[model samples]
Every structure is written in C-alpha cells, then in structure tokens.
Target: MRTVDEIFNEALTLPNASRVLLVEKLVESLDFDEDITHIDEAIQELWIEEAQKRIDEIRSGAVKAIPGEEALAQVRRLLEL
Candidate 1:
C-alpha cells in the first residue's frame, strides 16, 4: 500500500535506463483495475490539465509549433523507418 510519491521516489532511485523501462512497463500494464480506478482517474485528469497547459502556451505564443515536414522527418528518423 505504498503511496504514489513513495513508489515514484523508489523508481527514481533506479538507474536512468531501468527507470525508463520500469515506467514503460507500468504504462503498458495500466489496465482498468477496479481497485485503482480513482487513482487512474486522477492521473488522467492530470494528463488533461498538462495538455491544456501546452495548448494555452501555444495559443499565447510561448511555444512554437514544428512545421509538418520537419516533424515528419524527425519522426521517421526516430522510428528508423
């Protein structure tokens, strides 16, 4: 019954690559478990809020959007496709 912060702190102490792998596994396994629905809902709400903040930044000219071609090229390079 560890708190999220405690779990996160423990994960943070892992090596950088292992921490990333742990996060990836956690994300992949995040199915709709009935016991953790409330926690999942809170996480989703935070994601929405962060997305809204990014949108607001773009609207306020605080962040610039990448051009489509440049973005596509970067994606292709990352995917090695």
Candidate 2:
C-alpha cells in the first residue's frame, strides 16, 4: 500500500479536474471487505442514516445551512480558482 504522501504526490500529478474525478471514482469504488459482497450496500445504508441524522439536527436547529453561493465561493478560494 502506498503511504499518504506517496498517494498525494501521485494525485497531484493529475490535472486538477481529473484529480477531482479520480478521487470521486476512487471513493465510489472503495471496498470495505474482500469477503463481503454487500459492503457497498451497507455503506449506502450507513450514508442514508447519517444523512437523516443531519436532517434531524438541522430541523432541531443544531446545525446551520450554508448558502450555496457562499459555499461555492469558499471552495473556489480554497482551490485558488
């Protein structure tokens, strides 16, 4: 397995947009267990549960939503674009 630095260095060599897409594909293709075929389904269910939890938190005023434009601008700044 590659170390984090090695992986990051490799990722950095990819074009910016390609790196983002590659990361998205890598995340989507992650396998939790070689012995478990249902791992992706399990992860999907967990994500749904976590999303619902966040929704509940927002409903209860425990979390605040950021505006879409503001979030986009922040990301643009972070990426220096």
Candidate 3:
C-alpha cells in the first residue's frame, strides 16, 4: 500500500484543477457538519467565480499583470510600515 507521504507527493504533481477536486473530495469526506459544508461550498463557488473573472480580465487585457516577486515585495513593504 502507498504511504500517506507518497500519496501526497504524487498528488502534488497533479494539475491545479485536479488538485482542487481532490482536496474538495477529501474535505467533504471528513466534514460531519452539514451547515459548515454548505458554507464552505458557497465560499468555494464565490472564489471560483472570482478566479474566473480575474482570468478573463487578464486574457482580455483589461488589467495589467505584475510579476510575483514584485507583488510579494509590495506586500512586504506594506506590512513593514
């Protein structure tokens, strides 16, 4: 049988969508509170919609994209103040 660490390492190699699906399924399996599950699902849907909007904006050139390092540097500067 595969160890948990081995399975986790393999899961890390999956594409982002696959990883998200895997995580959702794992979380759902452990979720005992129906109310919390519903809330989590709603939040996930909102995030999915937001992410799609951002991707569309980037593709349409409606907004400029910044490099990751530059964005992180800006966040660090804000936190340091």
lDDT of 2 by residue, 1-81 (tens): 889999899889876667878888998997655766477689899999999998999999999989999999887775553
Q: Estimated TM-score per prediction?
A: 0.49, 0.49, 0.55
- What lDDT would each prediction earn against the true structure? 0.84, 0.84, 0.86
TM-score of model 3 vs. true structure: 0.55
Best candidate according to lDDT: 3
- Stronger candidate by lDDT (2 vs 3): 3
In terms of TM-score, which candidate is strongest?
Answer: 3
- RMSDs, each prediction? 5.4, 5.2, 13.4
Candidate 2's C-alpha runs over 4 A off are 1-37
Which 10-residue window of candidate 1 scores lowest in summed lDDT?
72-81
The residue pairs that clash in candidate 3, if any, are: none
Pairs in clash, predicted candidate 2:
none
